[model samples]
Target chain A: MAQSNGTDVRLMKGNEALAEAALRAGMQAYFGYPITPQSEVMEYLTMHAPEHPGVVILQAESELAAINMVYGAAGAGARVMISSSSPGISLMQEGLSYMTSAQLPALVVNVQRGGPGLGTIQPSQGDYFQAVKGGGHGDYRLIVLAPASVQEMVDFVFDAFRLTEKYRNPAMILADGALGQMMEKVALPPVGSLPRSAAPWATVGKPATRERNIVTSLFIQPERMEQINLQLQAKYRTLEKEEVRCEQLQMEDADFALVAFGLTSRICQKAMELARQKGIRVGLIRPITLYPFPSAVIRKAAGQVEAFVTVEMNAGQMVEDVRLAVDGTRPVHFTGRMGGMIPTPEEILAKIEAVVAEPSLQHA
Target chain B: MKEPDVIEGMEVVYRKPQTLTATPMHYCPGCSHGVVHKILMEVVDEMGIQDKTVGVAPVGCSVFAYDYMNVDMQEAAHGRASAVATGIRRVLPDTYVFAYQGDGDLAAIGTGETVHTVNRGENILMVFINNGIYGMTGGQMAPTSLLGMKTSTSPYGREAAVNGYPLRITELLAQLPGAYYVTRQSVHTTAAVRKCKKAIEASFRYQTEKRGTCFIEVVANCPSGWKMTPNEANDWLEKNMFPYYPIGDIKAPKQ
Candidate 1:
């Protein structure tokens, strides 16, 4: 096994980059099932696990089993992760609910494809609402990171683990089929950079020195369950306040804005340039953390921009959040392609032009 | 004093193991879940692995097995205990891990996880408590419910046409190569209790050898769920359940 002297660079697929980055970030175990657009993640880990001793990678029978395995490993104080595509992720919602209720920290990578039911193998942001708005039962939030490129995919693996462990909650890297399949240069984190932290609550067997550890989400009493829900809500509030992150691209004197994320955000950046060439004065706001959403930034921009156009590869999922942030002050228009369709810059630019060219907006 | 009379000459016949916590279990009187919990903890206590063992509790009557078992424990979702044990065992390979599940949890809802975990040869003990009914949910029919068993769901007694035949999951699991040790034991009799204790101890020992999955099916009784008194439930189990379940080892490792 060759040692990593910090600079381990490779042109890798987005899913592969995430897997390598997870291993480099000192992930202790990975349990996953095969799902299209993300199968390479486990494949890469299974092939490279020999190079990284002390890491356990197993292909589980199903997504439900994979997530529960993650739940168990995380409860046992292991840095663990699981990855799957959209439909498989849907199957994991029950386990995710259990994980969040137990307050176990683990990483879930959703390489999203089109959805509703076995939608398509192509990339889609249809799961944005699912990721941000409690896809599972119960009141819980997963710290969601949207990576637009393979490099961001590599970088956010460490960030997701850090956030999940720091807050003692589950975190998700919401990638799409496009970003998962695309190849780009990524600088993997140095080996052994992220050491396992001490988990006082982990069920690692109770020595006499400490009280026995019990990991569970079951609260038989209604008052006790309410108290746990209150605690989780409080944590979510802190996440919203402190963890909101986004890229404000060229908003310095803009009259209009384009709100997008992940792969669609890259397309929006191109559309912004196209709109700018037409004297539209459009800027792009790319949300990196979807859960602790960059609402404050979008609200601030709402005061300056005449209108906002949310571009997505789904049927206007994130547009709802953008509208909520804009708060009816400005018309937040939406243009999207659904069922595994990718929105072109020209199509998004047309929507932006129509929103700006509205007689009401022209008068304002 | 009355307490001091012949105290020194008395030999201890029975005592609650230290591994069984002082927390009184919530199981109904004569429910065999408590009995299984007692002997399982006894194994952990006698083996001196209470600190080295981790238990995964299922969602049925023993959902709070963590409360009564004084080891590091985790409560899993309804049927996912075996999968949860797999995660724990894989992460801490040397830790003695076991998943305690019930009839519905193991044979029905969690059958996939149970089968796959065994098939993968996950080095853990799976303690399945087959009460032939869903005890926690008010006496619903379980997959292992006898063909003519009556329950809340099976009001007219289970019929193969409507309810399907009982599943012999323990025997089915024994056929898998990953199942290194598979056995069926009961706790209705003093002799049966001893055999069940031995089975649990053997499963824990097999875990140390890294052989494969060790499974113990305790043909337990649910007095409250069956609407019977403790003695009646025990008698019923002996007469009716044993004929079908047949307490004995189904598979064992070669010498």
Candidate 2:
């Protein structure tokens, strides 16, 4: 409900807004390493965080150290966060997996750049599979959220912290280099108190009244560990039902629909406008939650639309999810740019037009 | 020396520190982790900081420290316990925090974390256990393994040309301006155990003084890993380990 106006909004990069909003959302600590594009998150926080009381900002020695520091802070019952980019995030997968098994709530930001391994600093959604499909080694999922704008980047910091507490699982704001670097006017969340019950399993000290709280991911006993895994899976099931977030535009009698998210979705929004002007009857379904992924809406769209086209900054990573959502009800087509390339609106528009022309491209 | 008079119907000593849990430790004979864990717990209990103490366990044989130490603990991945301890100490500033790590975990794989944590002056105690071999992972040659030492990984006695030299990590860390106390002691003998315990308590005390990181490296012996009996390991350690990782303080805070 908070909106940016002349008084409340100031044009800022997505990374800056994310940092500011996290502080406002009661983040007690920020631990991170400097990495390309994403480094601005820590930079902005370091510059502004001293103004906020009780906030601890630390520049970690490495991404490995940063994420583990987040693990420690999260275990200590602090509202903690960490930010990094692709190769850096790769370095953090072990720590992330530890947090997952521990079931600690942490807000992590990945201003992703190109990488199979340290590919480029340019924006790319190559990490979509990594974010939603458990980049860390575990039968777990990071509640992945894709923010398409500076506003959502700001807004989702609050959303991410809340969802993390609600499920007690790590939540990632999967933005790419463009969203992190682009400047826009954004309204930040007001300072609010996190509910005490958020981290019931946190390792607060053993006082006279409360028992000692131990936070760990190591479950050596096989049977009990399996039970914990099942319990985590159950919570994930609840999240899939409850946390599927998406935005639909111009679906009224649309014969063709475009599916994308984050930066690609914003590009698709422009492509949709261009397609509508050219009478293509194209619409958009912007998946706000990449993990739970708005599959129900896509299923609904599949009933009405003749075909679906997915645009992404990666080489057809998310198209697989769209296919599963449509489930052979209709045809699906994918077009993408990889290795740090961002596809333009005209390029996306041409792809959508081509999908509409070829009837046999349905199963693709 | 005479034993203190005992009072009837009163337990003079708790026997074990209250901070040590009832669960039995899985450390092998002469591994020194059990002795280190016991002494650390004793220090925590004696300091009356049991309720506010948090321990970060490293990924090695002692990763299961959480099961034995009564205090709240978080298990860090291999070589990141210092960073993890730093985070916890920052959040719970008033809480006494320490990281328990092995030579391979600290001196080798975690060298960066161990050095930088000391360099950053984080107010946490770092308990480094330098037993010449990697005990948990089948007695591999550790960074602190002696120049002529032979183990599973180095079946042919370690040669300086092939394996480099044993690392004097405490000496390396002593040069850091942020390190308030960098001491090397062992737990192989009763006298050494007492000195090691004193060093640990001193390091924990410095956390409250708001001084920089206190690194206490305990040069211990691993009998099973070294293919020696407990007494033989201690004798071998005295003959070989001490010459390389000599006892006594490498650096100390200003008096």
Candidate 3:
């Protein structure tokens, strides 16, 4: 694979970018069960994973089993990854919570599809609350990266690993079915010869110098368990300081700003361009990290903008966070499409136009 | 002040060595889990593969078997140990991988996974314990429960009208082309315990040689669930369970 110039030209779907990124980021094991829109990732890994030393791949029995396999492999300190759609990802919540409580560093890719039930295989961002609020049980957080472009899909996975290891927490790449299926030109990263760090706690085998290490989340005592929870909260606090990321476009002199992430961010960007052409001074705040959410950036933009229009593939999930970030300093509006439907750039532009025309109509 | 008591001294010398960890087991007293665990450890010691072997513990009563077993181990989700073991063995082909599962975990929830894994000819060992009931979940009727056995959930004694007949997992698995060895053994008596150990050792040997998927189903006794003494449970297993479930090899690789 030849390295291309670092221009964000694209020719890959969101799922493809994730697969390539896992390979580039030195992932050694991939345990996955087939689910819609995310199946390509497993197919890609099955073919290319073996070329790299230490790469272990398997098609697990179920989404539940796949995540548990990830837990097992992650416990052994192998750079591991798992991918699924919304419903499948839901089944993995128990194992994900276990991973979080155990502080097991791993990557989870959710190519979200429409859902409340087995909703459709089409694209939707309905998992916003699930991802940002820590879908599984306990007072915990997963470092979530919402990528809007195919290029960012590849880049964010590499970033997810770095952040996961740094915080010892599970990191997620939240993409939608459109991003997963749509193809675009992507400049691949140059494969490097860097030696990866070996986790001392991973259970490869008991080396002569160290005692056998057992990775588990079962704490019998309440006080000791509470202490673990407190430690996890502290780690998430430190992560918020070091990991929050986002992209700001033309927010300096704007009357209204658009906030979005993942596939909707791309549509919002296009909407912003069209709104600018129409002389409606609008900008965008595209979140790169959904968990250590880009709150400060939004707060800063709130001072300069009169109103904020939050656009998403789901119905008003991330808008809540945007509202909290502005903290009533300015008006906030929400527009979204659920059930695997993508709101067009024209639709988003129309919503922005409506928000700017009647400032009093903005949501609190 | 007294001479050595030869009989007591000899008895102490011949006792089974404690290979399992000394932690207080959470299993109920008289439960067959301890007996099965002891036999498995003895087999590991006899085969001299404790260093190279890796065990996958399921989410049933044996979820914490890894905590006691003196080897590299992973805890798999309920009934998914075979799939997890498949992942471990594929990556570390030289390492012997085995999954320990219960009847509810194997024949009920994990049947599809286990069947497909064996059909794929994964070279791993599977140790299934069939106690005709779900002991961990308070005596629920399992897929292997006898026709008229009463359980907590089945207070009216399992009837053919409501519940189906017991499933013979060894017989079911033996029909698959990928399954190289399928056997049903028991650990109710001292003689049967020795046979169970030999069967476990043989399964591990099959995995080491890459023969194919080796399945050993142990007809264990859940005395507490059965509402019987340990000895009575053994007798009950011999009289009631064995005739129906039957003990013997269903399939073995040709020499």
Candidate 4:
């Protein structure tokens, strides 16, 4: 097979790239329940998974059970993954909390759809807080990656696995349904040659040389529990330093910049392109890693920019993080679309131009 | 005076306890969870598949069954152990997989999961524990609680008009073609415990032999929930729960 730069380019949807990337990343097992827009991930895995030895794919009874199975396989030192949409991911929060507290490394993909309750399943980025914040309970955080395109979807899966093992924590690819179902050109990573090592802490049953190992997060003593939390917090600090990733575009001389991530980022990028062509000094800061968020970069950019306009598919989740990063040095404006409706580049351009035109908003 | 020769009779040999290290059980005293755990471990030991066996434990009194079974164990969400087991088995076909669940967990909130798993003909074993009432949550009314049975949630006794009748999961699952073996056994007495062991072993064997889904529903007594002494609860199970949830092979592969 001919390869371009040793990677094969293929047209695929965000969901398809996730499945392909997971399999190529040595993910031997997948347990997921089917939900709209994101169901294609399960469908693809179901059709193709049995061809590979050690690869397991199952349509679980619910998102709750699927994530627990991920916990089981991850405990066994297997590269396991699961995928679902907004409400489905909500159902999985309890198990995800357990996985977090237990410090198991696994991958969870959330193809967000609209929801407060059983919302429509077209496309929405309503799970912003749920993905970056602990989503579940307790004092814990997940390594969240946002993929804006099919190529990033493929790349993020491999990165998620590597980071998960490196940190011994759960990682999430927070894509909305728009990215999940949309088709785009993606260069697939090579199946072999990728790193495939489990953490020494993983429980894969005892061998003759070692004593039995137990993987649990429960601590009866408050001091021990506090110690564990401190340890986890230290790990998070290390991750924050090493894993922050983002994409900066045209921010150097711009009067204002649009901050976005995932599919919304793509729209913002396009809007910035259109605005620049019209002589408007607008730029974009698209975050690639939602957790370990690129706060420092935003802080530096805020020094030169007049204002930061945060655009998202949800009402206002990531906006909070953006505001915190700016630290009130500059005004941070917000605009969003919920219930699976996506904002077009034209709409974002309008929002950006409106913010730039307002005299009071420009300097203060 | 010559002291009698004191000899410690040859030091007794103690085998490693056959329980999983993943869980430390929180089962109540005299709960049938211990018996069920022993039976499953004995089967794994006898079959020489301890290293290749994966068990899924559900919520309820038996939620911690993983803690006491010496094998790869997964603790599943309430009522969803079977679905989790299905995922494990699909990925590791050579590994013997089973789920241990309780009445309220499997037959109530998880009813759809259980029925659909069985209907899909998942080649996994299901060990259903029917203890008449919910044990972990302070004796709440369970799907298996009989009519006129009082519980914390059903203080006036489970009136047929209000609470609906008890669910017979074995008979219900046996109707599906995907089920290769379906049996209801008990652990109330010595003979019943033996029978339950046999049923559990049969279910495991069916999965090993690549048969369809094998389901064994064990009619157990929860003295804590029944508000009786262990012996009285066993006797109560014999008199009250047994007839409604009869013990027999609803479907079994031909010998």
Candidate 5:
């Protein structure tokens, strides 16, 4: 029996949860185009915008327009956000680079679908490289948060806003079709619980008290541009030191480890449990923040585990990061299903067993 | 203490608008961007909306517009100024928002944003500076480049067979219901400068009235891009560009 607190704990699709969280997190404006697996985010915001006074929801003409709108609203010092899937996210790379260059704080949600070119509307982690590698051009990094569940889909939205504002850079909530469309119980924050602090640097009609502020990414002079790039690199280093978050499940006395993130992490967890039932020592490392890769944890675990097996929905993206973290102390194995294919726990378990038997595959 | 309006025997009949920043503009000599920037800032000054105006600067020659415009400004990507202005205006509806773009930025790469922004009736002012060439990138042929005109990209004169027809985007946008006021003006002479100033002033007023989108296209010239002296460029503009892109209001608000 549930308490009648006006459906305080309600089952919600991950996309809906993300939209609800944005409103509650004091999102001032939302500009997005309709894209697969994430269009519900905009639809929910539009339908419920009336409940949140002064909240602006607009369906932009295209992803390019949507991203620029985010840039514009962010420059005006509003808590703004944009959501899109794979193909749409590709259109936003230029805008993302500009936002990062200007050091503007905003949120971008990528509910990823299979892609190389409009591949499928199904779940896949192919965008892991694109998200963490500064998908846009130039030397820039976005604070990428991987939410593995519907609850996290709601929670990371709030985290993204806070982190982006704190660092004065953009942040991304990287989910997938599975997490976006799946339904689960989530506790949405109370309305207006999170009030964003005023951004003094915002260009909202400069007052006489301060010199007018300019939000721009164009530093024409080569020397000046280099200086700006250095400044951005320094900020990214600080983020790496302070914001690396991950979940280590049942690592104590484990001889093997499985590393993954987002939806794949959930699947890996099930596989770990299956391996444990077979009298095998297996652990799971779920990286919540993909940008500041949890290298230290994986490196430390490498000394304890004989081998690591990475399971993903992509051809093999995050596996590279896993291999880099291991640093040859132990062999790192990878098993992936591409083009919108989900690896069953049994398949992942088999890979773990194979890695455990070989311990060091010559090609690993 | 504020300086006296009258210094010595000089009554100071004319002076730079306070809304125009002290930063030295990087525009080439005889570029219409400087005049347009001055006139637009003058409107911001005279209307006393300097503190309530947000400007969006486009990528072309005026990419450094934020350095010259005293008001809060955002420099948008090439051709994305109108979309950026839409974001700013929606967030701060009370603020007077405007986007300044060039022929290449507006009529070429940003045509989609410009058309859609006006179609949605975004309550902002869009200032288009059409020089018929890409000034910042060293005089490439722009979408608004007159046919038979030779540019870097069209070295052998723009042929109708090779290059598409010059786009009359201003007239095309005027047909949209969202365009509350659409006009084309220039700053070639004293009278033209005054008319261009009035158009900008009215555009801001219409923005405050929530009269959809107010677009003003200035048929200007680029001396460096056109490979001509400043005076030659102005003369060329009046003699050549005018015949194709006439100066006057193409659309106006109803009483």
Candidate 6:
């Protein structure tokens, strides 16, 4: 059953749940350019926004326009959001950076697809690095959340908006094509009463006694820019300690560990199940927050496991983080299924077995 | 003998607007940005909406617009001012929103945002400063750089084949039904400043009335970038740039 605080449970696509959850999280506006795997988000809002009073929905000419619109709305102190796929996400990188630097709170859902260019409409984990690390120019971080299920997609967007406001920083819900399109039971929470115009920092206009608020990142002075960067870095450090999240599964007694997130985490769950049934002790570490990267859990797992195998739908993007968490102490191997390819549970189970059985790694 | 005063009464012809801060702008001497900035703030003060106005500044010299304008302001990335303004207007439809941008920002890199924001008929004012060359990034050639004009990037004079043609953006935008008001003015002369100020005032009123997109293009002079004295730059602008970019209303709000 779906769960979210005495709300009705319904089977929904990840994208649809995201839209509903945004409404529940008190979204003032949603601006987006449609792309595969995430178009339903805009579609859902366009169809249902009339029923949700006071919520604004607009389709931008492009991702570039959509992101800038979000920046403007967020700067005005409106809780806004935008969603697109890989190629479209690439177009928004500049605006995303601006939003972060300007210290505007926003939500961006990048339902990743295969790409270095307009590669494919199918699912891929290629944007892990872009989402966790700085996607745009400059030194910045997006509070990155990776949702493994449709239910999680619903929950994470709400969490993202909360974290976005709490820190006054942009948060990214980095899902993939598989998760966005997949159907699962999701709980629709009660409608939030916080109005978009209620943002204390928002520019509803200057009042008689209040000072004007300027939302900008331009620091012409080198020292001032450095100070802003230092401040951002300090906030990031605090977030890392307070926000790191991961789900450890069947890790009590295991010789091998599978590190993955999003759809790959679901695949790893089955792989762990398959390995356990075959008398092979394997655990799964599903990182929910990619930025505050569940490194401590990996560090703890290093003492329990002899080897680590990271499985991804991309060319092993998240594996690099896995390796860093393991810190070269344990054998961290990778198996990628890119260009829309998915790793099967049996395949991942075999890869785990091979990690302990062989000196050289085996490909999936 | 009565204490004789040289002047019995002094009249105040002009005063800085309360909408503008006392902070000295970083604009170079003889730059049109200062004039354009003054007129806009004057409109804000005259309308008595300083608290209800939000300005979006471009990534060029006016990126520090927040430092000068005593209203809530946002600094947009190069060319995305219109897009940002659209967002603000959409959410806070009651508030007055405007974007201050340079030619490079409005015509070249930000061309898409500029065109689309106008085309959407967003209730925002766009004050475009067409200086013909990139000001903040030194004397680089811009999309509005005139034919045969020499820039740092176009050192041998702008060749239409190599450097491309100067884009008359406001004129082109006149074709869109969404842009209810489109005007091209200058900031060099006192008479022109008054006209521009009235145009800005009219536009601000239309914005409050929820009229469509209102665009005002100011053909400004750039002394430092053009390698001319402030006086020479004004003369050159009137002689050369004026003939090419004549000031007038390209379109007026639909009746």
Q: Where is model 6 more than 4 Å wrong at Cα?
A: A1-6, A193-199, A359-364, B1-8
Question: Per-residue lDDT of A1-364 in model 4, one digit per residue for the tens?
Answer: 3467867888888898889888888888898998988889989988777766668887776787688678767766678899998889999898788777778888999988888899998788888898888888788899999988888889999999999888888999998888888888888877864687745554443343444343555554799989989988999999889999999998888888899998888888888899999898987898888999999999999998888999999898898999999999988998888887888899888888888888986444
Candidates ranked by DockQ: 5, 1, 6, 2, 3, 4
Model 2 steric clash pairs:
none
**Residues A1-364, candidate 3, lDDT per residue (tens digit)?**
3344654344677687779778878888898999997899999888887677768888877887788778777766677899999999999998889888878888999999998899999999999999989998888889999888788888887888888877889999999888888887787664542235667765554433544455667665899899999999999888788888999898878888999998888888889999999998898999899999999999999888888999988879999999999999988899989898889999999998887779474544
lDDT (tens digit, per residue) of candidate 4 on B1-255: 222344476553533344444454577778888877877787777767766677777777766565577666667667777776776676667778888899988999889889988988988899899988999889999999999999998998999889888888789899999999999988777888888878877877778688689999888989888888889988898899888988889998899
**DockQ values per model:** 0.89, 0.74, 0.30, 0.29, 0.90, 0.78
In terms of DockQ, the best-performing candidate is: 5
* lDDT per residue as tens, model 2, A206-319: 665665677888888999899989999999899999999999999886889999999998888889999999998998999999998888999999988989999999889889
The lowest-lDDT stretch of 10 consecutive residues in candidate 4 chain B is B12-21
Off by over 4 Å in 2: A1-7, A193-198, A361-364, B1-14
Residue A148, model 5: Cα distance from true site in angstroms: 1.0
Compose the digit string of candidate 6's lDDT tens values, residues B1-255. Answer: 123333458655567777888899999998899889988999899889988999999988778888888899888988899999999999998899999999999999999989999998999999999989998899899999999999999999999998778999888998998898999999898999999998999999998777689999999999999999998999999999888888999998656
Q: A154 in model 5: Cα distance from truth in Å?
A: 0.8
Residue-by-residue lDDT tens digits, candidate 2, B162-240? 9999999999999998999999999989999999999999998889998899999998888889888999988988888
lDDT for residue B22 in candidate 5, whole number 0-100? 82
lDDT per residue (tens digit) for residues A301-320 in model 5 = 99898888888999889889
Worst 10 residues of 5 chain B by lDDT: B1-10
Q: Residue by residue across B174-236, what tens digits does model 1's lDDT show?
A: 999999999999998889999999999999999999999999999989999899999999999
Write down the DockQ of candidate 1. Answer: 0.89
Query: Which pairs clash in the backbone of model 6?
Result: A206-B51
Give the per-residue lDDT digits (tens) of candidate 1, residues A60-156. Answer: 9999899999989999999999999999999999999999899999999999998779888999998998899989999999999999999999999
Q: State the displacement of the C-alpha of residue B146, model 5, in Å, after optimal TM-score superposition.
A: 0.6
Ten consecutive residues with minimal summed lDDT in candidate 1 chain A? A1-10
